[model samples]
Every structure is written in structure tokens, then in C-alpha cells.
Target: MGIQINGKGLLIVLSGPSGAGKGTVCSALRQQAPELVYSVSATTRPPREGEVEGISYFFKTRKEFRRMIDQGELLEWARYVDNYYGTPRRFVEERLNEGKDVLLEIEVQGAKQVKECFPEAVFIFLLPPSMDELHARIKGRGTESEQVMTDRMQAAREELNQIHSYDYVVVNDEVARACHHIRSILVAEHHRRDRIFKEQPDWLEGI
Candidate 1:
């Protein structure tokens, strides 16, 4: 049987620049730590190829998304290119209440907003080896127009300055190595004196 923890789950927020391999690193971390819950965001944009409705994102119409915002149902939200993207508050809260660590892979703007609401969350920033490599990776996607690519590069430069706000930084030079660092962070966080004591059994008291 697996060990049962009595404490509330951790809220882990990950953010990075456009070509920082945040998705790739999150995928590897999920495979390694299957017990961790991946937070599914809600978006007004239509699903792309192979994207599932609730699994990838809860597809909401613009009106519905705005309603959710008005009702305070989202943890954090942002608009990009006339599309809305936001983290739903209920699902993440339910999972955390059940003692399942929840991970949110979001953009830097949304991550900053989440920090205001959830100051206890583990904030991690993903980074590329270098700016040149980041540019190369963005161009390698081959789907964006020249203007779009230039805009993304400029955004990346600005996002890099936000690294100081995060609690940890993981460089995605190698997928396995990056995942290992993240796992270490999780383990260390769990072993924190407060978290450990919060989960300690009543029977161990006065021992």
C-alpha cells in the first residue's frame, strides 16, 4: 500500500518563455510523478488537433469564460490575441483538498497573477540554456510568421527578467535532467518541517 499523507496538497506553478520547453518538461515530470495532478485550464480558443475537451482544456465560449471571470471562478486569467485562457479555481481546489499535488503549467503573466492568490504555491520558472538557443527553438517550430516570431522573441527577452520572482529555476538543457531537478524540489518541499509536522500522525505525539 502507498503511504497516506494527511496534509493538504501542494499547488505548484510553472512558467516560462515561449520556447523554454515548459510543455516538454511538464510532460516528463508527469510521467515520472504519476500521482501529481495536472491542472486543466479553461480557454475560449477552439481545441487544436488531438486536444481533448476536459483533458487538454475545458473549452468555453467567450461569453461563458467572461461569466466565470465575473463569478470569481478562476484562479488567474489572461487574454491573448482576443482569446481567453485561465485556470479554473474549483478543480484545483478539490484536488488539493484531497491531498494530491496539483501542477499548473502557465505563462508568466498568469503565473504572476496566481502568485497573488496563492502565495504558498511552489513557483518554478523554466529556462533555456541561452537566448540564442531559445530563438532557435522558437524558429524551429516553423508555424509562426516572421512578424509573430519576432514578437515572440521580444516577449521572451522580457519574460527572462521575471526569473527573479520565481522560487526555483529549471534549465531545460536536457529533459531528464530538468525533470530530476523538479522531482528534487518536490521532495524537498514535502520534507519541510511545517509540512512534515502537519502530516504527522496523532499517535506519534509525545514520542
Candidate 2:
């Protein structure tokens, strides 16, 4: 029998602009690959309608979030919309150690923080087909006011400019297709030379 290469789980950071359908793609990925754990961020923003405290996010007071920062518990953090949001270090570390791939769905700024802390992470930048389509999608969602929609579009443009920074760029024209592409990227990463060697040390030595 051939030597087995133990697979080390991947740390994947998925980021995109507001109207890029990143959340939709991520949801599809989770459904297809039930093993992927979505890292629920801790946020100071009040829970939205139908958002459970711990499930959607670990809702924390600004003071409590600051305490976590002081205790060095957060892996990466950023302030947005007058609130703080951060990924807890302990939670991600524990999952990685247990060999479960962890997915972080966050913004461009937050993804930068993750890159700094976890350089091994594979970053995927989700993009819309075009700016006009992005605007149409954002407006169609009907969840935000005109002013908020404008602001989101502006932010999306800024985020789009940084697409070259990422390891992989997936233009999310079709939800299912985009999800399939992302899943392929993740699966391919696990079979990389370094990962394969690390997971099966004896395989390299015997050859």
C-alpha cells in the first residue's frame, strides 16, 4: 500500500465588496462541504433581525470587545460602522489543530489583518460581473436606504481596486458556478507539495 498523506486543514479567507454575493457563495460552499466551519466574528453592532447572538456572531459590548483585545484574544480586528468586529484567535486555532478547514467571510480590511496573522491562509477575492450589475443587485436586495446603497457602492469600488492583492479571484456571475470554483480551489490547495509533504513525511524520505 502507498503511504498516506494526512491532510492538514486549510485556513481560507474569502473577501469581497458588498454586492459581490460573497455571502451567497459562502453559504453554498458550506452546504456542499459540510465540514467547513464558518468563523463567526464577534461584533459590537446590535444583532440584526433574525440574527442569533452566538450563531450569527458573538455580540459583544464595545467595552467587552476592548477587554478581549487587551487580553490578546483576537486574531484580527477592525472597526466598522461605529462598531468593532474581530475573529477570536482561540476559536480558529483550536479548529485548525483539529484538522477542520475554517472559512472567514469578511471585508477587504479584515482580510488584510488575517493575512498578517496567518500568512499561510489562502485568500480568495470575490468580484461582481460589473459595477452596474453590482448596483442593481444591491438595490434589488431592498434592505438598505438609497444613501446606504450609495455608500456601499462606493466602498465596493474601493474594494475592487485591491483585487490584485488576493491569491485567487472568483468573479461571482453565477452562484453555483462560483461556489464550485471556490470548492475546487480549496481542494487543490490541500494537495500542495508543502502540505502533502508535511502530512506524509515518510513518503518523501523513502523516495
Candidate 3:
């Protein structure tokens, strides 16, 4: 009789500078690969129009979020503009243990913390074709003031310094091409000899 090969899961973390089209690429990746689980983060920020609980965010009060931090219930967390946002440990672990790959799209601060907590996780950094392009993308939004845009451009430069921490980098010159690169990375990762052996130790048992 053949032994059953255990199929484990992966935690795929995607991050980039603010104007690097992280959301665009992630949304496309999800549409192409619906089987991947999208990780929902816990945040103290209130829901906006049409945002749903457990979908947009796991909305929590400041007290609740503080308790989670104190109890080590969060895998990673950060305070942004005076609001708490974090990845809950239990939520991610439960899905991972069930052989479902979880896709987490996070900011630089939160992504840095997650790298420390889960070294085995796949970390992908998305980048614009050039700094000028990134600045243009931010300016194109027109929702922010010139000063705000300048600040974001500066921050993006700082965040780019952390690209060395990621396993792969995809330049977002085109959304389709970027998505293809990311998808290829995910597929190739599953075929790595070490990963194959680790996730399915008994694949050849009794053969």
C-alpha cells in the first residue's frame, strides 16, 4: 500500500513601496489563483463604505488590539498614523496547518516584522520600473497634496532599501508581466527538492 504524502501550506508575503502597484498586482494574482487564501489583518481603523468584517479587516477596538499584542497573539504588528494594524497569529496558523497557502499583502513595517517571525515564508518585493515612474504613479492619483506626494516618494526610496530582504523582486512595468513573474515564482517554489521532501516526506515510502 502507498503511504499518504502530507501536503503542507505556504505563507506567501508580498510587499513593495506605496506606489509600486502592490494592490493591483495582488488583485490580479488573486483573480488568477482563487485557491490561495488572502490573509485578513486586524486593525483598529473603522470600516469605510462597503468594507466588511473578516474581509476588509478584522476590526478591533484599541483595548482588544492591545491585549492581543500583550498576549503575543499577533505574528506581526505596527502602529500607522495612530492606528493599530497587525496579522493575527491564530488566523494564519490555522489555515496554514490545513494545507492552504496564505497570501499576505503588507506594508514595509509589517513585512519586516513578519520576516523575523516566519523566515520560511516566501517574500516577494514589487518595484516600479524606475523612481520617476513611481513618483508619476503617486502624482497621477491626484488625491494627495504636492507635499504629501513628495513625502511618499521619499518613503518609497527608503523602503526600496529593504529589497535585499526579499527572495524575489518583480518590476511592475506592466501588471500582467509582473503577475506572471509572481505566479511563476510560486509554481517553481513548490517544485524545489527541499520543499518537496519536507512537505511530502512519505511520497516514496514503501515504493
Candidate 4:
């Protein structure tokens, strides 16, 4: 029989420029790997239509969010478009301790903050097939004004500069393919020698 292994869960951070389909890929990943925990973020923004508190986000007031920051309750946080968004520390820790892989879908800026706090997390950067494709996707949204779109494109350009800091780069050409790549990455990480040794099976004690 093959050696039995007990492995700690992986902390995965997924980030990409706007319109790169991070949400679509993540949704596919959830369907493919139902056991993985999706980390819900806390935000100061008002809820949109059909959004439920603690399900869509832990909606907090600006004062409460500021308090969380002061108390260091957040793993990472960033302000975008005059609203605060952040990941809570306790839920992630609890899930990881239960040996459940946790996925954090965040912005590049927030990902950098998370890197500082949890360097061991498997950071994945999603990329569009090309700049033209990215631009097209952003334009296709039909929800933003030309000025807002222009600003988003500019932000995307800046976010691209931080790609080197991530552990892996996955091009989101198709949702299923990208989710497959993420699943493969998790499997490979679980098989890493260091992680395997850290599990320290009794069989290895005398070898």
C-alpha cells in the first residue's frame, strides 16, 4: 500500500486585474473542489441587490472597519473606490486548522499585504490572454463609464508590475482550464517533500 499522508491545508491567495475573470474561475474552482473553503471578506461598502451579510461579505460600517484595523483583526486590507475591504484573520485560521484548504480572492494590493502576513500562502496571479483581451473584457461589462473604465485600465497596468511576486501565474483563458490548473497546483503542493516531511509519519521515525 502507498504511504498514508496527513497534510495541512493550503492557504491560497488568488488575485488578478479587474475583468480578468477571477470570479468566474473561482466559482468553477468551488464547483470542482467543494471541500475548499472560500474566505469571505469584510467590507465597508453598502450591500448591492441580493447580497446577504456574512454570506456575500461581512458588511461593516467604516468605524467598525477602522476598529478592526486598529485591533489587527484583518489578515489584509485595502481601500478601493472609497470603500474598505479586508479578510478577517480568525475564520481562515479556524478552517486551516481543520485541514481545509482556504481560498482568498482579493485584489493585488491586498494580496501583497497578505504576503507580508502569511508568506507561506500559495499566491496565484490570474492573467488575461493579452492586454487587448483585458481591455475588451473590461469594456464588455457595460456597467462603467468611460472615465471609470480608463481608470480601471490604468490600475490593471500597475497591477501587472507585481506579477513577479506571486508563486504561480495562470492565464484565465477558460474557467474550467484555469480551475484545473489550480487543482493541480494544490495537489502538487501537498506532495512537496518539505510538507510531507513536516507531517512526520511514525513510519519515518527510525528510517
On TM-score, the leading prediction is: 3
Model 1 lDDT per residue over 1-207, tens place: 333444788999999999999989988888999999999999999999999998989999999999999998999999989999999999999999898899999988898889888888999999999989998998899898999999999999898889899999999999999999988998888777767666654535555
TM-score versus the correct structure, for each prediction: 0.87, 0.87, 0.91, 0.89
Full ranking by lDDT? 4, 1, 3, 2
Model 3 vs. true fold: TM: 0.91
Candidate 4 residue-wise lDDT at 167: 95
Q: Could you give candidate 3's per-residue lDDT for residues 8-116 as a string of tens digits?
A: 6788999999999999988998898898889999999999999999988999999999999999999899998999999998999999889888999998778888888
Off by over 4 Å in 4: 1-4, 46-49, 201-203
Worst 10 residues of 1 by lDDT: 198-207
lDDT of 3 at 129: 97
Candidate 4 structure quality by residue, lDDT tens digits, 5-105: 54678899999999999999988888888999999999999999999987899999999999999998999999889999899998798888788899999
Clashes of each: 0, 0, 0, 0
Q: Write the per-residue lDDT of candidate 2 for residues 50-159, one digit (tens) a residue.
A: 99976899999999999999998887899878999899988898888888899999888888878888889999999899899999999998898999998998898898
lDDT of 1 at 186: 86
TM-score of 2: 0.87
Clashing pairs in 2: none
Q: What is the C-alpha RMSD of each candidate to the true structure, in Å?
A: 2.9, 2.4, 2.1, 2.3
Q: Score candidate 1 by lDDT.
A: 0.90
